[model samples]
Target: MDDYQRLVVAQFFESLPNLSPELCHQFVLRHIVPALLPKTTSKVDVQPSAFQGSMSYTAILHIHSTHGGHRIVVQFRTEKQDLSGVTEASCIHGSIVPLVTYQGMYEELFVYTSPFAEGTPYISVLTSSDDFELPLWKKMAIVMDLADLVTRGARANNVPPDTAIVELTTTLDKTQHAVNDYAFQNISVRTSISACVSYVLSQLHNIVTLPLTLTHQDLSPFNYLIDLSTGNVKAVLDWDGALYLPVGSNFHFLDSLFGFMTLKGWQDADDRHELEAAFYDRALDSLAAQGYKGITKEKLELQKAIGMLLYGVERLLKSKDEHSEHYLDGYLRGLSFMKEPISSSY
Candidate 1:
């Protein structure tokens, strides 16, 4: 491991005084190393990841075998937050494998029992994205390509009926409950807006029965690796959130919207609108090519608006701090669009 990586791991352990270093080392040797390496492997390097905002402890492992050397990222989650069910579902539903070989997406290498006897319960190893720098436009292209590939692949391959998709209705219902239960700082006005947004989304869900497809529910630009030099997408990361959803879910689009909004600040409305228009045009064309004929400009706008409102509500509900009112601004903006008739042409 590099000096920086060692320091990070040491700091992590230092923060947890009760945990023994020897036990942690043995845990890695016993469980992680074996699952990721060959018996003939002579050397291994483990380094703590520098990524932020993840709920799991992450590290990158370099393994050297007789054949060659390769790198893998390992993530460990607490028993209470164990992702075994999600991983198992991906495997059983045949979503993970095809994403790598058939769809040209990245591979989720392995999932194993965590070596930490307490607190942590499961560990997952996945292929690394190799960290290629990319510009905003390039990232947008990659997101569009991923959406197209997954939608087409789902239509071609008969995806099995999974409980995740079947439970989406229940999930939407819970989302409505979250909105109603949200203790807004301005409870009177915000609650009225929240209820209206929730009702609109529920109505859309009832009226539009779009064909389901494999969707990366969380499709932010950070979850992908793009080679800025060639404008090519090297890998699509983080399949833990992948599931079967409406073909034009717009999760990626919303991600791109909010991402650019943060980077450019909320004041640059023109550029944001331009990017949204371009993304929607490309998405509509791609879906049409895949024999999805029902999506008109009006329907596309409605879907995109609903996607924005849904994510905004989720953000507000998940926020634990007093900053929820700040998030409510986004929800209110989305609701305004839902109330008016949006232009079919961006």
Candidate 2:
């Protein structure tokens, strides 16, 4: 390993102090190897790139490990001499939270929590050298699976079409309010269109309240996956921030899916031709069939607003010690997006 690689490995291990060399080796073999390096009948082509950083670069290492059954990936990089050492030292002393903390028993949350203890196979980044803090891939898988389960369950319960529309609306409202409240309390950021937010909020609020369900608080492209083979969702990542809120909360996953599709530039005229209202209508009907009482768009949007604000506050408060303003911009952006028209789709 070069100086950079050595530093990267050292920092990873230092963060995850509980990680023995054996476990680290296993992780590399089991997870990293599979994604970056898939089965090749002939010679395999491998490209190496470094994770960008101001003072350090992280390189991917493909090494066959003896501890695990398969190959593994070891990401190695170096940091600024001054910052790297300080950063590693912090990990050595910091307390770590296992993914287990998110586990629980419930119809909605159960699908998510059960997987962890049940050997829900996943790849995790060995941060804090602890067996917690899941890697992106594993987290994504869990959320996607839970989303599917929720959809299926809704259908089984005889949910109605309006339920999904209501939930989606409600979620947007919650998110907007959360962002506004947090910004006013902790920062000076304000939205330009107050009426837009109100209009959207009102559209959703008129919808009736429904039973609570499981919703991933933070859903984005990085959080989900779609299996090409089965045309089914392979996984939904990032459950650390998962919560059991109103029915609208469930729509958070949809926004993530839409965002992913949109970002990939998949929303072309041709793609739209393949997609019809039926695609969404059927899914929404399924949720209603599953017995979901639709939440008004207003309620869901408010909840989403609140959720965003809480998350923003969390980032600011946590980083206050370091005087980091990293998430402030994001907080403001999230609020701005919330105060928009409700007729806008996810």
Candidate 3:
């Protein structure tokens, strides 16, 4: 092959090493080039076959698409074979269980390669057989567990409740006041956010502190997988947002409340409203009962302000995709619930 042809051939081989020359070239021309090429290459149409495997308690499945050409999405399912005498459904992600096989304690949780895509490959339960769906109240219980987990975890890590609250608020307010066209990092929402948050921290200089624990900063439904049968949370996914040390306060409640609100917004005008309210109430009560003594009225008010700001910022950063926009809108409304000053009705 000439120099130009050789260069193209070498590049193609590097893209997908296992495939034969013809197949590699086909994959390249069909998926790679069109994706990488300037607005010139033609798009091809094809769907690749999917592969699946089953181990002791888990099953792995991977789906490929030659046309869409996204990353290989693999799914792991825990088969829970010992369901004979169990009163409730059993789940095994992020749990401290003894290892019975190659899937380590964490492996049972989830680990897979996902390069820029929605719905990363991961484990989920068999929803079809059990017809599993947690009622609103039960779901709220899970949210509360999450909130306490975060609050305790943060305090243990030496994050003063006040600082945590301030930073959290600043991040939110900055995001909300940001103009739509302005980019977030510079003229970004983070600017004003940092300022307000800084002021809050200055005011709450003396709060008792403890060592920090793990903070799952993004505890939204997208990252959490809930077991509907027992009202248990199976896994807390995506630690990418987790932070260590004292950033003042932990922002764990941010996500759970957002999740609660999204669910609330979807309720039917009549029945759904009541159900959603019950869910939110349960979660708030549960958080309060579980030692999440979030300072005073002023602190709580700041949390709401920052929380709303954060929501707006979050919404502004949302993708223009259909599903993304839909979810963002729901979460934004959820954030709204926290914005109001004290109200007799929750």
Candidate 4:
């Protein structure tokens, strides 16, 4: 490592007394910097990454090279077991290769040696998306186009592998376990929420029997890059949580829209509901064109509700770790959605 990088590592070690300085420095030189900029001899600046609130070991660096400069975000794990799953997910770029060819979406992947002290293996580096301000309509259009592409591409290209299904079921089981273990102040409320989730999962079994697709399980607004001038999505970020799961996993799109509308100061709940319904209608029509069947307004609503519950419970589980009140609020809001009855007709 260079003088600047060494100094940074020394500072980091000072703050993290449990970590070894020699090992951390070795990780920076051998794995982190090289992964940040491959095959470069140019002067690069390494700073703390702008991305925050992540559970893993993360570093966002601004790199200056001979050609130009760009930002690189990195996530690593200290333990071998914790590193394996993320490493495997990072390497699975092939699943979304077709979708990246479509307009309004982009994907790039970089794999390098693992930064861990032992059991070192390959890890991934991805291009961080740019932040651009755009009109609400324009942003929604970009998101809809991306959702369509991901859904259709999975349909036309390949069937979901057995391993993918196994992973999905495993995650669902974990969510169930988390729900059962939830430490709510009211035992009756917790029981009711757990029962609701169970009912939804039972209903979802039939839906899972249908074809599966590569889905951006986390589709928040912050995960996308948009060209403000044209309002087109230039890139999509954070594929580590992506999965080959059942289609209509675009609930994150709605979650993002809710947040966006709130941020934009939309006061009327009816207006937000209209926008969401319109987006769902457009999405359903697009998927239909690609030969996806069995989608109805009621089913779509149920899917979104189940998705919200899963997301909330997952966040609730994490709140125990991060002690964030925001996660607790999200979990309660998700439970409220779970209480709604899934009707057959809209």
Candidate 5:
């Protein structure tokens, strides 16, 4: 481990004061090895990684023996990390989610493991796949899985709707402040960005009042997997910051399937095919088929708009530097509808 790696590990074990590397080693030998490999003794290789996600300290375990080899991923939650309603998520999401074969706590750290799922992250697929051949069905498959996540994971183990709305409202308000700050610093985009945000905020109630579901907080390419051949979903990874919010909160990511984001905004794949209407039709139909009725086309349009607006602003605020700012500027510029007002019935 380098200096930064040492620092990362040191920071992680701060909360687990009683959990040293030695303890983790022994625990793996006594508990994990037996549980995973059974009575036969195996050469256990515990590799502590610098690969920590937004919520946990992660490590890799390689167990080799006469039978075979097993590679497992281990994660220890930080003190502030809250995976409050995620225990049932795997079962809810089925094989499309990483399977957690083991989980337990030690020295106040929430630790768990999943047998490594074999597939490339969706980001990699998009980045390397040939000739921009990302088909529409792959995008639809992801949306279908999302519909399943929404209907099956409905309200179960979710935060109270009112409370969830309050939290979401706080986030929107914070973004409003951030936008104001950004506009104050960069006067060039001030008026246009401000007006767009104002339009979104003015129509925000339409977004908050829709059906509530577990919103995957981070819906980036890095968090999901796609098959290279059929382009279907392989697995959805890292449910750490999952929260309860109105449907379509995660819809912003659905665009990446049919389009690619450049420094200049969302450019449609294969040049001119924007599939938003197709997605909404499939999603609404899926919801109705699953007995989650009452979703009108009007509501879904508003959901997509509000979700995209909220997410775009979030990326703008979370942008680390001017390179990111340029990319965001292009993305926001393409959202011409945000500048147009919506008739709110909420």
Candidate 6:
């Protein structure tokens, strides 16, 4: 890259002074080019990346070497880096997770790179009808692939088993405590949402211990890059914050299979009952491998209902508004289907 181009990239981070000129220079030499990242780099170009991460400043590093040109996404973190999270996810779900090519601290900044994925983001398809044709079956296939990965990711870890004897009401009480902690104090809408919570709790009166596992909390459409031609996911991005949680918590992500949220409320897609049922069935089969005592499909669904209730209340806690409240009510009222009402990611 030319000096002027370097200056351009450097100047772009003026509002973020941590990207000092020296740090930018070494980033270009070490990460953008050199080593296995690409051999003997020659000409190059750098531009800001479109991947809008909440915790970092990101850019695209395009390099032309002896063999050919290559592209990598570089991120400078504003928070403590959990670089292993991306590597761990890649170890299991490499097909959908870009492997971290390199990671190091230039000065105090934590920077990492992964091969740039080539495809349309699932979010793009959701926004415009003409981005590409994504049929119902193809979307179903994507959901299955995601479900398989989550189950495998959980089992991949040697998590300590939940040795507590299976007492059903204990789990329900934990839900009640979470509600009292995270969902309480929002007096305006609590009453409106109370019936929904009570009904879910009642359904989950008898249950088994659900083993904890790592969950990709940000399973938004934008994080998934789709192969538009086949309607499959090519890469799952942004794993810096991935951590372990209850296995049933993943049910909240099922909303992405339907549609995304908008200001008018949720703009849902055509009903995919076939896909939805298949996903639940797949979950029951896969999670059963963990062999928690006294587990049953009914108990699993009960846990899902608990997950559904928590999903609503926790979200309500984060955003107390007429719009959020309106959708929270609709979703819990229909917890059997575990439908998502509001768009968490636009």
Top model number, lDDT: 5
TM-score of every candidate relative to the true structure: 0.63, 0.40, 0.41, 0.57, 0.70, 0.71
Candidate 1 residue runs with Cα over 4 Å from true position:
1-17, 20-26, 35-38, 65-68, 79-136, 154-181, 186-207, 250-253, 257-270, 304-311, 320-325, 331-346
Candidates sorted by TM-score, best first: 6, 5, 1, 4, 3, 2
lDDT of 5 by residue, 130-233 (tens): 64456667666665655455445554224554665577567667766777777433454545555555555555545555666777777777777767666566
- Count of clashing residue pairs in every prediction: 0, 57, 16, 1, 0, 2
Show model 4 residue runs off by greater than 4 Å.
Answer: 1-15, 18-41, 56-135, 156-181, 186-195, 198-206, 228-231, 250-253, 260-270, 318-346
What is residue 295's positional error in candidate 6, in angstroms? 5.8
Which candidate, 3 or 5, has the higher lDDT? 5
What are the RMSDs of all candidates, in order?
Answer: 8.8, 14.5, 15.0, 9.9, 5.7, 6.9
Q: Name the candidate that leads on TM-score.
A: 6
Error of 4 at 266 (Å): 14
Supply the TM-score for candidate 3.
0.41
Clashing pairs in 5: none
lDDT of each: 0.47, 0.37, 0.37, 0.47, 0.62, 0.61
| Tens digit of per-residue lDDT, candidate 1, span 193-269 | 55544554444633255555666555555554445454344544445556565665644344333332332222223
Looking at model 4, residue 321 earns an lDDT score of: 40
TM-score of 2: 0.40
Q: What is the lDDT of residue 34 in candidate 2?
A: 60
Residue lDDT tens for model 2, 1-346: 3465456545555654564335533544454446445773223222222222222222233333354323211322222122232233223212111121121222111211111111211221222224333334433444444444434422122345378556656655665565555434324333522444455445443433444444455554433334432334444433443433544444433332221222222221222212322233444555566665453334444544444444544555555522223333333233334435445433
Question: Candidate 1 lDDT (Cα, whole model)?
Answer: 0.47
Evaluate model 4: give its lDDT.
0.47
CA shift of 146, model 5, Å = 4.0
Tell me which residue pairs clash in candidate 4: 49-60
What is the C-alpha lDDT profile of model 3 across 256-310, one tens digit per residue? 3323223223211223344444444543454455465444433433343344345
